[model samples]
Target: MTFTDILREENDDVFQKIFSHPFVQGIGKGDVPKEALAHYIKADYEYLNAFMHIYGAAISKSGSREDIQYFNNQIDFVLNSEIHPHNNFCKHIGASYEELQGYPLPPTADHYVKHMMYHAHMGGLGEITGALLPCPWTYLEIGKELVKLYKPTVNHPFYHWITFYANEQVEETTLQMRKRLDDLASKASEKELEQMKIAFRKSCQLELAFWEMAYTCEEWPVRDYVKV
Candidate 1:
């Protein structure tokens, strides 16, 4: 089996939790509290900003024009394509995507982005891809699964969000990233491959935590203790 297949099999439990999370299920039923959706929109907007930076880091670490262009295209997709769903959801929730940009990254999101940044700064392309792969890939999995389970109609509150991630474009990008990682793994030393595995697993854990964070609207504990 391919390395990604291995990772997926191992991380199936976590992915299952993510799929069953209230936040995701709410999206399916179109009944999630607007506040929860607002929290997710704000936090995810910040998270995607950091996500794009990792792509930039990957471009810097790339040794080939092909790799650079791939990251560039992903950056464009994030900016132009991926966020359209966010914008649409924002309109429905009566929030401005532009205003959400200034909201602080929630604690879980901060930790998640730092995890990716650590790998991006300290490792090569393989490590960067390893850390980066979970975001899009897992969302694609969730999107596809949601569609299969819920059969969300066009009138579903998050129909665009669900369909956006489940679409061919997302699957294509995910497969391309997987192909890139598999290519990198083909030449990697065992030690390097193990590090990539570690990165992949940890990122999967973080992805699950991200859904929990959205469901809870997680905030810093310090904020509770230290009143302004």
Candidate 2:
């Protein structure tokens, strides 16, 4: 099977566990803790900023003009739609852009962001896609859990909020990424393909770490500011 196939297969178990977690269930039922909700939103905003910065660099490095254009278009859409709208959402959640920007991120957040940049810099599109798979893919998997766990009267704003990310948005992004990866793999050299495999594994492992950190409320250097 191709690397994409392998990734989908490997992620199956992780996705199930994420959706089943009590925290995720709370989201489905619309009953998340206020603090947890705030943290999730803030962290996601910060991470998106970091992601776009790194993706911009990756697009610059793409060898093919077509790939470069694609990356640029994707980045543009994210900024105009995702990031901009998220900022507005934060306001609705009683948060300000300044506050979200000032809040500290966990160490895992930094590690995850850096990993994406590294892959983009060294691995081209296939490697970059491999590295990125964990983000949306993880959300998509966890979303399934939400669907299973959802309740009608939970009254949890955060639950619905998370659903937006993990379910609809994440699924859309994953499908687009899968297409991109297929395109890249078909054209990539054998060496590049091998690198993509390694990147995929590493990214998956990082994803596991990302969830563990989030679930356990682990604090790192960045956590100094954003206590869980």
Say which candidate scores most in lDDT.
1
**Model 1: lDDT of residue 166:** 96
- Full-model lDDT for every candidate: 0.88, 0.66
- Against the hidden reference, what TM-scores do the models get? 0.95, 0.76
**Alpha-carbon shift of residue 61 in model 2 (angstroms):** 2.5
Q: Candidate 2: worst 10 consecutive residues by lDDT?
A: 151-160
Off by over 4 Å in 1: 224-228
- Give the clash count for model 1: 0
Q: For model 2, how does the per-residue alpha-carbon lDDT over 62-175 read when each residue is reduced to its tens digit? A: 788877776776677566656543553465567775676655567777777887878888767788877776766776666565555553333545444455555565577788
Native-vs-model 2 lDDT? 0.66
Q: Per-residue alpha-carbon lDDT of model 1 for 28-93, expressed as tens digits?
A: 877788777788888888888899999999999999999899999999998889778888679888
Give the TM-score comparing model 1 with the true structure, all chains together: 0.95
The per-residue C-alpha lDDT of model 1 at residue 195 equals 84
lDDT of 1: 0.88
Candidate 2: stretches off by over 4 Å: 83-94, 151-156, 159-163, 166-170, 215-217, 221-228
